[model samples]
Target: MATSAATPHNKIIGQRELVVIVALLMSLNALAIDAMLPALGQMAAELNVQDGNRRQLVVAVYLLANGLGCLLPGSLADRFGRRPVLFVSLAAYAACSLLIAAIHSFEVLLALRGIQGVLCAGLMVVPTAIIRDQYEGDKMARLMSLVSAVFITVPVIAPSLGQGVLLFAGWRWIFILFAVVAAVTGLWVWLRLPETLHPENRQRVELPVVLRNMRTGLLNRGAIGYVLGAGLLVGAVFGYVNSAQQLLGEHFGVGEWFPLVFGGTAAMMAVSNIVNSRIVERFGARRVSHAGVLTFIVVSAAQVWAAHYRPGELAVFLPLMATNLMLLGFLGANFGSIAMQPFARIAGAASSVQTFCRMFGAAVVGLLIGQAYDGSARPFAHALLMCSVSALVLVLFSEKGRLFRRLNPPRQQQPAGPPPV
Candidate 1:
């Protein structure tokens, strides 16, 4: 509900418009990954890829690059401005997409995907910085929940969008579409979005300065611990993403109906975000996310049991996978806010570090789990179960052995992080 008081007269923009733009910006990465799920088969075929599991690199590589890519943007955003950084990054993304479309070698294709992901870092880091610039505390949490609600739609539909594109055009055109969309978004950003980084707050974009700020952000145990903990929780979802196509289409026999099945599972994440947005103010983020993590552990245990003793058909697989992903919504919406909450001064750099840890860690975890795929759900289920257990351990450490307590809560000015349960 906050408004831009700096805007002239009747043209003031507020939370609603900010929510839409931020959500769209955040959606770029989700769309980039999800839309490619349906095309993994065709991409493997066209490129002469021999192994089905290796094809997962098409998703994993991009994500890995995206995480490592965050290192520079946060420092840059803090110094130059969010707008220019976004513009240049989007332009680079478009160019990389075009370059990727023409590349024939698998190695070269992966190289370009890495570069594209690096460019996509702007879209990922800047908007969260923008949100932090505008709001704080529980208000920030509530607004993020709303942004996530809208952003989740991208995953719910991206596979279908990619499938429709695949129906007529080849897989290469998918990258071409990436080029086109980035160009349009770049223009929109250039024209409408104002610079969120205030002049007085701008720091010099130098290596020493950047490192010092990054070190400051890293020193906060509350932030650092939560970043590592949440990464493990979300990493389980990334593992599923790495194998979604093979698991749903080939192993379970969903075939052309793959998008619908994928989207249905993803829709739960969106619904959870909406529900979180509704009740986060009343119940506090720590309490709800803790419950979600507990639920995730239970589901993960059931999945491991089912996969080991007797792997079920698609009917059994769908609900278990879908429910686990849904739990991620509670973690995602709150965890980011938690990590960024205490370091408002270095929001951009802090955001980058926290996000980098989560993504890089999750990418490694997902890559391992994906490589372990044996045309069965055992690897994925086992990975999730282990991750959920690890997540609990992390949650304890992050909160100093807390489980459900919300010490001081977020609405009131209180301690740095959650209290012990």
Candidate 2:
């Protein structure tokens, strides 16, 4: 409820409009990956990709590139402006997507995918930085939740879109679709998005200064904890993503219907995001995130146990997987807001470092899980359980064992002297 007028330094545009645009921007990352799921096999076949495992490179490489790209453009945005960086990056992303669609060799495809990831760095970091430019505390959390709520719809629809493209036009058309969407988004961003990083508030692009700020941000106890926790949470989600199709199609025999099933579960997470948006202001981000993480831990552990006993039961598997993903919707927005809370002066750098850690962590975890794919769901379940527990421990330690303490402190306890008297 802190009005923009109170902080002249931070100009608030239309919050609702900004949230929608940022959400669309963030959805691009998910769309890039999710929309390729149904086409992975076809892409591999068409490109004569030798290694079956290497086919995942199309997705993994993109994510790794995205993480690496986060390092520089964030600083550039702080120096230049958010809108310019964002528009340029989106255009580059569109070019990469088009290149990927037209490429015949796997090498070229991999390189294009990686470049796409790198270009998306602007899309990933700038919108969050812009939100930080204008809002903080619960307001930031609320806006992020709204953004997440909007983004949740991407996963729900992307797979279906991919499948439709595959059914009609073939897999290359998937990348073409990505290119078209990126082009449209780029134009919209150029025309509609204003410069969020004001001229007066711009920081000079000093390498030493950027490094120093990054170091400081990383060293902050709360920021580090939230970053690591967010990373672990995302890593688990990525692990699930890298393995979900195989688990469903090959193991459970879901076949071409896999996309519908996947999209349905994603809709469950979307519902969780909507709920988070409603209650985040009153219940507090820390409480919601901590609760969600714990719920994730519990569900993941149960999944491990159940999978051990009945490894092939889709009934046992799918529902638990959906629930865990829903929990992530609660964790994602809150973790970012929590990490950025203590670093206001250098919000851009803080956002960058935090994003870098999350993506890097997720890439590592996803790669590890991807390697463990042995035509069973056991490895994925095990990784999820381990990650959830690790994240829970980190969150608890980060908040000084007060992870769920009320954001609004309780009234002071009366002295015990009255009882003695």
Candidate 3:
């Protein structure tokens, strides 16, 4: 397929430019979450946070806010436009970051962090809706894969960046750094990104209409299954992220090198993302995603068993951790594509609802697992086992109780190629 002719405002910005823009916007969530990892301990100390385990709440609250944020913006973008919603959300995110920087008490910090998470939800939902507005099938997968590849780097570098700021300035500067990045990104979007949703395609924002669309989306058997499955997958990842610093630093005594170790694991995820991008076109998104989910379950189960017997060995843990992270690369992109496939006509509303389910569902699961933290790797392993089993069950239900059967059966495979953007 030839590229579409550029719009007047997009004369200099081709598909590549649009992909980068969407990727950057989507990456805000990752950067916010990952960047805070190194600063978690320091923030706890500075805010005089009483409970050692409660520090994880700083991260969990933000994710919970993000889940809540996804619901309203989808309808808003459908009514107003993607550009306006995005601009407003980014600006709000910047303001929240600044407020977070100024907070002294842990309770206030938690509230502000939740606000930031909610603001960040717009960044995640709108970009995919925008992409659906312009492209579909393999092209959408390619663009998303490319974006995932780029977005994965945020985790790779974010902890290192946070650690550097903490070492030099203070924990407060982490929020300052987030503010600066959000402002720059907001300005870029305000100037460069065009409104993809035309007036005719825009849906009315009446409460009744929004509710009908959301209800319709949820009622679709395929949509519900994929959304819940994706949520469970994300819950697994969040569970790991919430405890990673503690596992690496306190348990393993990596201490100062914790960020580097975490970053390296993140880099492996990026590598798997690249691999997924390459293979998705040839094998098809459904086949690849289903296989990946099964693989993840097996790997997670192995980790649980190993932890039970060899709780003290890094050798027993590190490889499984890397494998689990790598599997997420596969799950993240394909699950989104699969869930959206059935709802492309009402992409905005569908994206919003599915995103809300995934983020909020994950937040709830992650928070529950986090509260069970017992100052050891037990919480992490148990969480993974629970998530993997739950996700596998959801996957089965999503496929109409067909466990391990193909979601989309493979036809003759397409030639392995770069995804269309």
Candidate 4:
């Protein structure tokens, strides 16, 4: 419930407003991805895409570019401030959305999506930096969970929104809607959002300084380990998303009910975020997330067995997938907060590096898993199990062979990295 202080311009950014605005900002990315799900079949048909897996590149290429794009914005935000970086990125993202709507060639569409991903990178990294600016540890996790609760709602509805657009108009209208949403969000930030980066903490935007700051962020033992661990879990989700249309709509024969089915599973994730927000402070992030991860592994193993034995069974498939999404709800914010606990002084650079690691690694993992789809859930289920196992190993390394520990020791206890300014 901590509110941001009045800006120099006297705009009062209350906690509620901040959380809502931040969630909306993050939702732009989710909307872009999720709203495209129902339209993938149409898009591939119109574009003459012959390979089923290649259509997934629409999502995969954006994700890969988005990860690479994460590398620059943090250093820029650290130098220029969060508001400017976010505003410019939003403007450009909107433009890319419009450009995507107009492109006729599939190659041009993917290139535009790649550029849009790069622009949207700021949208992903900067709000996170803003959150890290205001809070840390479990409080940060709590607020992030709240933000996630709202942000996740996009996934719950965006497929339906896309389906609606497709019913009335062409699939391109989805991008037009994306443009409109981004423009509105960008204007709101330009006018109301304050400079959260303290004036003194701003660094010079130079290669040496940027590199040093990035190195500090990337080299931290705990942060890097958690970043990789969390990235794997997230990558597993991306793999599912990439193949969801095919698996749910075509293979499962859900057809037009696909949006509702996808949204239902996503709604479970939103519910999980709400529950995590409620309990995270009391239980501490590590214990809650650790339990979630272990539970996820067990569930993933069940998923593998079910998929191998009963690939066509929706009753078994839907609930297990929904449970995994719910488990991710517990893991994402907690892992991110733990990873970010050490970087109070260099929140922007650190956030950027951490985001880059997670997004880039997840993108690569998602691409591989998505392309491995063979008209069955086996690949997706196996990928989930592999990802969870790998994540557990990384988390153990990060905690020095421990699991389910409480809050990480404070910055002074860390072996490396700058203390809070």
TM-score of each: 0.93, 0.92, 0.92, 0.96
Worst 10 residues of 3 by lDDT: 412-421
Runs of candidate 3 with Cα error greater than 4 angstroms are 1-12, 402-421
For model 3, how does the per-residue alpha-carbon lDDT over 80-187 read when each residue is reduced to its tens digit?
778788888888888998888887899998888887888778898999988877766555676788788888899889999999987789888888888899899987
Output the better candidate (3/4) by TM-score: 4
| Of 3 and 4, the candidate ranking higher by lDDT | 4
Ranking by lDDT: 4, 1, 2, 3
- Give the alpha carbon lDDT tens digit for every residue of 139-229 in model 1: 7788999999999999899999999999899988988898888888777766667667655556666666667777766556566766887
lDDT of 2 at 202: 61
The models' CA-based lDDT, in order, is 0.80, 0.80, 0.78, 0.88
Q: Give the candidates in order of TM-score, highest first.
A: 4, 1, 2, 3
Clashing pairs in 4: none
Q: Please give the distance, in angstroms, between residue 22's alpha carbon in candidate 3 and its true position after superposition.
A: 1.2
Question: Residue 39 CA error for candidate 2 (Å)?
Answer: 0.5
**Tens digit of lDDT per residue, candidate 4, span 280-376?**
9999999999999999999999999999898899999999999999999999999999988888767888889899999999999999999999998
| Local lDDT at 52 for model 4 | 91
Which candidate would rank higher by TM-score, 1 or 2?
1
Report residue 115 deviation for candidate 4 (angstroms): 0.9
Question: In candidate 2, which residue ranges exceed 4 Å CA deviation?
Answer: 1-13, 407-421
